[model samples]
Target chain A: MTYCVGIRTNEATIMISDSRTSAGVDNISSYSKMWRYGIPGERQFVICSAGNLATTQAVIAAIERDIKNTAETSLLTVADMHQAAEYIGKVSVAVQEKAGGGAVFEATFLLAGEILGSLSGLYMIYAQGNYIASSRQVPYLQIGEIKYGKPILDRVIQESTTIDRAIVCGLISMDATLKSNLTVGPPIELYILQHGSLTLGRYRSFGEDDEYMRDLRKLWNKAMESAVDAMPRLTLS
Target chain B: MTYCVGIRTNEATIMISDSRTSAGVDNISSYSKMWRYGIPGERQFVICSAGNLATTQAVIAAIERDIKNTAETSLLTVADMHQAAEYIGKVSVAVQEKAGGGAVFEATFLLAGEILGSLSGLYMIYAQGNYIASSRQVPYLQIGEIKYGKPILDRVIQESTTIDRAIVCGLISMDATLKSNLTVGPPIELYILQHGSLTLGRYRSFGEDDEYMRDLRKLWNKAMESAVDAMPRLTLS
Candidate 1:
């Protein structure tokens, strides 16, 4: 299981994903699920995957392979974010059909990025190759073990949230997920892409022992504890 | 999809459940998932159901029939809390087999109660007729759409947590679930049973327009929003 969340705010689009994968309790492994594709200052796409590792890896490999082949419908050939998402979706669907047969080779993704001129956005790609972008009413999309971390995003994130605050909210949401579930764990990888700051190195990975991650976890836990403590005390009538 | 949470504390045990049941997105209706079976003051058990609505109703009907029949095993005939849990589990399995041959008549339960002289505890019964009790390390058990509401419970509930606070935590957990999930919603039924207060009428249902429910929802959303605001702002190094 993986937990990946993408927050699209007015200033920036942020995507965060946990790095833990386990076929079972005994076969636990760590795999980075973040992939960036683009030409610097022209276009950028950050993809966070969750589901079958083999399928996700295959999709990633296929996307990379497409970039190397001009004939293929690569991200570079796509004119807009929608086409980029559709291309990834098509690649993902074709890869699963060839590798998984009738079995479930499910891999969902959160794609967030911007072209040179169009609106910056976030899209959640389904295992079935369909996708939906974030709207004004809902400015975030989450994949994988999403439920554990969703309440915080539902409450705190908005279209007007600042990039710094969006990053913080995404980190808090990821922290909540990592604490409650083993399938999703650190190091958490985050890509913060503002609409125009298309520099190639706008990504960071917070390892298990990273100072900021530790402090944020402790801080957020205390904050949530206090929130519950301050709830109205119910009295028997 | 239902969301039922039961928290057992040193002083009191409480159970809260949503009232929504659906065959699909198009067909949905409200059905109370809470039931109580016991002699007042002498013994009482609160049962919260999640999963197939038909199977849950069937199990409830069977338990009621057993209570009326002195020959068969029933909640009344059970000697200890374990026997009571096992009896309910067995009845659940039998009822599911009868109604849903191979079509997955799954219904999970949270059973919390006490006998006249035995311990007051909580048990989570699986569809396979097996059950596990809550421990000091884990003082709460949730069924149905549990993940959305789990982080708050994981961070707040403890063995020493006050019954009032546990009730608050349960409410917050249920509220989070109801907000993020469609399968779980109001009217929310809650039961607060203390170690010694084996009283009837402790059960209350907060309807969609309940004032307190509205206030708590507003309060919790504000609390979470404030928490996100208070996070240490991240500065790119």
Candidate 2:
């Protein structure tokens, strides 16, 4: 299991992913779920993967292969984010098809980035190879184990949210997911792409012992404790 | 779909259940998911239901029929809380079995209460007619749309948590679930039974416009906004 989220604010596009992949309770391993590909200052794409590890790995491998092969319709050559989504979706479906159907080989992705001239956008590419973009009204899309991390996003994210605040919300959202499920863990990968900046932007990874992660947890816990203590006492009226 | 959670603090057993029921998106309605059966001062039980509404309704109906009939094995006559769970679990499986096998008629329950001579306890009765008690380590069980509401419980609940705090956490947990899913909503029912008291302690229902609910949401949202703001800023180190 995995958890990933892509939030597109007016200021930037932030993508967050947890690295822990578990085949079962006893066999857990860390694998980076976020992949970035592009020619700097030209266009950039960050793909976050979830679901069957092999399937996601295969789809990602196929994407990297296309870029290396200089295929006619790779991420590098795709005209727009929509075309990139279509190409990735087709690759995902083809990979799953080649695996042959027996058990579930499904994978899901949240694709976020921009073309040279267009604005940054977020798309969720489904296991079925279809995709949908985030609108201004709903400026985020999440894949994999989404629910535990979703309420915070629903509460805090909006069109006008600043880039720093949006990234903080994304990190907290990932924290909630990690706290609730052992299958999802760190070091969490977070990528931020500011509006109009086609470069990779700031990329950070948070491991278990990382100071920022620990400090954020402490601060949130203190906030929760204070919030719980200060609420109007229930009178049972 | 519904969201129900039961938390057993040393001070009290708190149960919260949303009122939404739906066969499909267009056919959603409100239904009370919490039911109480007791001999007042002698013993008490609160059964929170999830899954097939008809099956839960039938199981409750059958239990009520038995109590009214003054049967030898009614909830009023069950020797202990475990017997009560067994009785309810058997009834649930029987109700589902009676509905035939082509479709799913399963229901799950969280049973919490105390008998006159025993300590207060919490039990989660499975649809297959089995049950397990909440321990000091776990202290809570949730059913239905559980993930969105689970992180708060995991973060805030403990053996020493106060009844007021538990109830607040439960309300906030339900709020998160409600915010994330349309299938779960108001008015939410909350029941708290204190230890050694074979009677319902506090019972409250929160509707869409309930003032306390509104205030709590406001307070929590403010808390989250501030928590986000106060956290250590990302340095991308």
RMSD of each: 1.9, 1.6
The segments of candidate 2 whose C-alpha lies over 4 angstroms from its true place after superposition are: A101-103, B101-103
lDDT of 2 by residue, B24-130 (tens): 99998999999987777899889999999999999999999999999889888888888988999999888999998334798999999899887788899988989
TM-score of each predicted structure versus truth: 0.95, 0.96
Task: Evaluate candidate 1 and give its CAPRI docking class based on DockQ.
Answer: medium
The true-structure Cα RMSD of candidate 2 reads 1.6
Shift in Å, residue B99, candidate 2? 1.4
Location of the lowest summed lDDT over 10 successive residues in candidate 1 chain A? A95-104
Report, for every candidate in turn, its global Cα lDDT versus the true structure. Answer: 0.87, 0.88
Q: Alpha carbon lDDT of residue A219, candidate 2?
A: 79
Best by TM-score: 2
Q: Per-residue lDDT for B150 in model 1?
A: 92
| B9-120: candidate 1 lDDT, tens digit per residue | 9988899999999989989999999998778877889999998888999999988988888746788878778998999899989988888555468899999999877899
Off by over 4 Å in 1: A69-72
Query: Candidate 1 lDDT (Cα, whole model)?
Result: 0.87
